[model samples]
Target: MVDQKTPADAAASRGRGGAPAIRERLTRRKPVEELVAETQAAEGTGLQRHMGFWQLSMIGIGATLGTGIFVVLGEAVPVAGPAVILSFVLAGLTALFSALAYAEMAGMIPASGSAYSYSYATIGEFMAWVCGWCLMLTYGVSVAAVGVGWGEYINELLHLTTGLSLPQALLAGPMEGGLVNLPAAAVVLLSMFALLGGVRESSRLNAVMVVVKVAILVMFVAIAVTAVQEGNFAPFMPMGMAGVSAAGATLFFSYIGFDSVSTASEEARNPQRDLPRAIMFSMILVTAIYCLVAFAAVGAFNWTGFADGETSLAGILTKVTGTPVWAVVFAAGAVLALASVVLVVLYSQTRILYAMSRDGLIPAAFSEVDAKGTPCINTLVTSLVIAVLAALVPLGPLADATSIGTLFAFALVNVAVLVLRRTRPDLPRAFRVPGAPVTPVLGVLACAFLMFSMSLSVWLAFLAWLAVGFAVYFGYGMRRSALERV
Candidate 1:
């Protein structure tokens, strides 16, 4: 249990030597019981439980499906050749490990904080802060990254339909020789408006978009698979296993938001019953669709041609059909696909901050909700910040940074599963990761394996981000924590 540190308890701890007292404070775990109590405590004034299995599944599928399939394929195919299909499979397996652990934790804890709250309940405060910090980077920056991808398809759509596209000055960031990415900024703000309206409405809209995008991809597969050139499959592993591993690391960004379903715990009507099923089901369905698209795309077009960046899959559709109509249709689908990603990821970002702020780790403003049970101030402020990042940051750096942070967070979650199983054996868990120590151990190793594939520059950026997080914790969260103040 997370014992509240009264003045007397603090005094007693201080008497037991300074170093020991500090260590005790840092490793303090929050009780699962109390976490649930707080959920009930804030119900009428905080997030409402409006999500079901269907809405939760949409959160995972919408966030994962179209983002990487439509955007990253152009980048990843060049690196891994036709074997980019294997990269998708490799990335999917890595995500499966983490998803199993997430299912167990969501069943036991059911907190909106996602991996952050799991760490707080299983490990301690310091680790929880680290996980929350990484999640902030993972979800927030990824929304911007996907927003930039949204701009790519929007430009493609205009070019296909009207023979005119937005100029470079309005299409990219300073690093890419453009003034600002206007479409990126515009889409994020539009998603923000949707979020501020309410969670149920936002989710319903996302479900519709998910159906549309799926149909579009299925249609592409049907048309493109028939035109497969046998020569395209030769020399598949051009750059070899290293290239496949590297591409897998990059493609892993696509799987980043599947766990957003776990983050929706507090908003789900039956978290224990629905969250676990949704996580596994969504991951399986998305992986099947992703691998199918990659296989069809590679078979239909020479892998080398993907490097040309002509919106590969859409371009392939147009090539096979002998018309630009398919490209236009595909581009329209991409717009909706990426917009769905922005909505789900942006929603995850706000909820994680809400949990942190409620625990006094950040400002209390983040925890405040309006009559409709939305964090009005939190949504607006986060949306504006993300919109700025989308507008000013280049997609490459944003994507690399997001993947590193997301990998770190997923590794921590795997460790949390091991920690909780040993520490809280009596806790009632609705779902369980099958292989115990072995499974959770492999999950951690798999996450680290992919994380090692990133470039040195990306690793340096990850360390710098962590350094800043530590500063914030010591400067603000350390003393202001609710565990201490209570």
Candidate 2:
């Protein structure tokens, strides 16, 4: 009775029922310091910490080398003719520049949030939320896009091997009167479960897939390069610079996953040391592969035949080799590569949301961890939305939107490096971008140029998304920002 009579005990008990005590309130809604502290405490949680430079390089390759090379080739070759090779070089340059910028910013921050986190610390709270939102939508839509792409190729492979295939109406989108894209939805669901298991497992899976993808391309290249007739490259730029620009903009998607490697900085064993090397290595490797593939694909087929039909590697096999077997293999490769891409993009999307949630920009549930220490709630919500998208919508709109969002994010990251250097000279940087002002400026210009080359419809849709993002940020994120409380 005497012990229960204390005023301090009663006040503490009442505090639990009222608003949380000051310490509890502050802890739950973290300030920047608290956020940093929490992240530090949870070091080496989702991803393993022993990843070496070689593993990091493989991760970059695994992320970048898929869907882009196998699939985008069919779409890009017709745009620029043989000069599509040059367009690849152009896209590679922009990716490299942006990657350099990301390397510097990511190293300095050494955090899990990727571009969104860099923007938050350097720019402001509002911009960070906008970037985070855009990253989510970009990667989320990419999952659906990749899944749908995967279904098409997988069906092609089954028919090739078994001499049986599903009808178009059964396999295609609702607009095409299909009930649902079953295979595409299946791949997304499967990838989600794989990711939920753990990051290390996913990385190993990606590494194996990347090796398979590279080996297939190497076989195609080795066989096709010897067959190059001089006449095929005669009218190299038949469509000229306009065509080159269009192709560069389209081929830009091939380079999409390079930046994604940077997204794992928070999980990297030695982010500052390894991130730049990984980004550069992946870009150089993919650029060389793309150029070689473009050369081989064009060498084997006449330019005129491309105008008559979509110039896919599979189509080339059908035309030049007069055999359906190679076509089947190319299509099978596309299916596998696209499936891997969907998995990686979806993983990146959930992590970005998890980061934002932890910072109080979104709902707290997004950051909540299950027994596995994965953001189970965020993963489920993201995968479900992507699966629904795959089942219904056509892929064209979402794919274009994804490219625009990526270019915009990349441009901001380049600028972010410059901004940080000026504002926080004292911050320890694990990596520094070589050029001070000029390099980042060129990076921004290159990205902008590619962005303008995109369809006008994409620009309009992007603007609309941006406007909505601004509204959301001002209305909710601004007041709830953890940075503000700090």
Candidate 3:
């Protein structure tokens, strides 16, 4: 008798609450505790943890040791001259700040989606969506750009070894006065099918390709060292400090593959321990190799010569050896190596979408896994999109856009680390960034500085892409979010 309410009255009260529910849901934050619990539950049920440190490290190396070294050297060396060696060091330092941040967050979160998942658990839904959107731009465009670079190497190999090559019209995009880059599209499709096959199988293949890639680079370094000319070192900073900074920003794209390691957090057998080590190891290894290769290549051939060669590394080898045989070998190695990069990048893109889909930010179909425990539909969709880009877009613009998108993602990752540390001081991190606040602050600043160094046109394209993402979020993601129902 004490103020009992009827069922209809309770229903009316619920309806009143429903009015604000959309706003509340749209802004809802996924707490780190819940994210951690969900990750544990998912690990117990799906997403097998099979990757060890070496396999994961190989993935990072495989993704990173491709286009930036093979193709970007041609563009960057021309700007900074032999001082491109310092550019490599600067870019590695910038990448290391973010890598350290990623290591801490990855150890704490131990989930896929990398920065996007970190953002959701710390910053809220809106920022998570933004990070995920930027990642899509980064991985998607990178796959295409790397594919185009692979096509160039393939043509160089065929022309050198077989005395035949695809016609220029078929080997380049329409923007480059060609109808389509058939080889680029073909490589993307191949990598797509390899990824769809299974994660374990794809990892095995990537590991093998990584070995081949490292071997060829070592061979190039060994041979080119014998032909070093001190004359090439003159005018080392021809364009001065500004150009070195600019070149470092341009070459920042090379360091991006290390984050792919963090994306595999859910698949790592011991993510908390292995991820941080793998991230740092791969970054250090790649940086060392980059510095060595830059030094060797410039010493073997004039830096100005690199600007004129599409296949820069191979061209340097050819000039050093006084024959095309070594260049052909390098080209073959590049073709195989870049294919691995495409595989890893494409896998990263699928897994990121899978995470977003599971959060109800995208279609649930994307998160659907097959018997092999891979997101088949997501892989297929990502492959198709990347294939189109590879076939029709030129490499220069796509490469710049990829760098901007990646830097944006890196900046957010650093910010996420700082926020998580402040908000959840009690959370256990398997790997902590060396400096609290100081390290992550510098990481954020470094990423921002590089981002601003990008061309204005690339920024405009990035903004347009984000605008489209916002439209999709409002039109579909907001209403469909699983948290809304909760």
Candidate 4:
């Protein structure tokens, strides 16, 4: 017994059905098939797959197309002038770099955790936990971000219909000197009830909502184009590239939800093929809409007129058509659009948390399924948290924070593709990023450039968030992780 083991014996022990050394435990990669098997084995309890190509595509579009165009265009135009169109393109290009990577990974892994799950199978357990933490920030905070936008537009509808505007104190959050954001809180609660109805029902509702919102945007493009003034295009780059970059960084938050499509891996009818298609299609459609809307907005109205972007489209419609009728209609459409965002993104937030829970990184209740084939406890808890934030926190800084977290998650996803390709070249990929190391490398650089464009305050806030995540991981996830028991 004391004779000791050979190198082969030592290596064999590492692959045995048990936990290895602490260092090995931290870096252990969950096998791709094992990831799918765990979900398949729990068939009765796991999330059911029902969504087809169009439904999956709607989830991405519904979530990705809101707020960015509805509310952000107003905020962006003031900074970038007519160049805001360029900002939208820049952000879309940055997102495309990462989206290609997401398509490759989603086709291979097809797990609910998305980038977090992808990181686990390609990177390691520890990195996966941190990635999940960033995703929590991305989806959870964006719910509140879009909810606040919903509240703003709902107020616009009220003002248009009855000529009564809600007081600033009632509409704004505490940071903005308002006591509570009632509509913001109300929208999230409504979305929670919708989720409790089950994924199929919710997806149907989201698809209808998506159709209405997209039509509204198209109406804006048509009506606004009639009033386009060539004179407005004279100083297109007034603020120059610096302003364009800043606006692009801010607008990056708008592109966060396309990844929500990947989070549907376990719910998609044919994730291996459909997920990639949905993600790419959503990006192209959303980007075209963004550019068209920005172009029409600046052309139809002076960039200086976008003083308050929350209701920019409605204002532009009113100014162009000279009637509050079209404005009211646009405002109503925005209410639908932003609500759709809350619904789809809330669904995404729950699924990501559910994935983390199954890995033993969080409470088990999140992973538990209800009779309706949904995570009731998880949905209820996430909705409540997001509702509170929507009611109390201001939107600007939170939106920026969401962008940074989203970019951080996307950058890691690009890295994961490169890692997996090199480590397991034999793994089958239904979709592949064309240029590999070079493409992913550029994605990383693009994300980093945009991140650096943020103000120092945003960086400080993000680092504070990362610190708390590290604390949670070391204190609980490390010891309780499912891998530790393997």
Higher-TM-score candidate among 2 and 3? 3
lDDT at residue 54 of model 3 (Cα atoms): 100
Candidate lDDT values, in order: 0.89, 0.75, 0.88, 0.90
- Work out the TM-score per prediction: 0.97, 0.88, 0.95, 0.95
User: What is the per-residue lDDT of model 3 for residues 89-183, given as tens digits with 9 covering 90 to 100?
Assistant: 88999999999998899888888889999998777788789899999999999999999999999998888898998999999888989999999
Q: What is the lDDT for 136 in model 2?
A: 72
Q: Candidate 1: minimum summed lDDT over ten consecutive residues — where?
A: 13-22
The better candidate by TM-score, 2 or 4, is 4
State each model's C-alpha RMSD to the native.
2.0, 7.3, 4.2, 3.4
Instruction: Report lDDT (Cα) of residue 66, candidate 3.
Output: 91
CA lDDT, candidate 3, residue 472: 93
Clashing pairs in 2: none
**Clash count (model 1, backbone only):** 0
Best by TM-score: 1
| Total backbone collisions for each predicted model | 0, 0, 0, 0
User: Which residue pairs overlap in candidate 1's backbone?
Assistant: none
Cα lDDT tens digits for candidate 2, 23-92: 4332232223443465677764543355566667776776677656666666677778888888888888
Ranking by TM-score, best first? 1, 4, 3, 2
Lowest summed lDDT window (length 10), candidate 2: 23-32
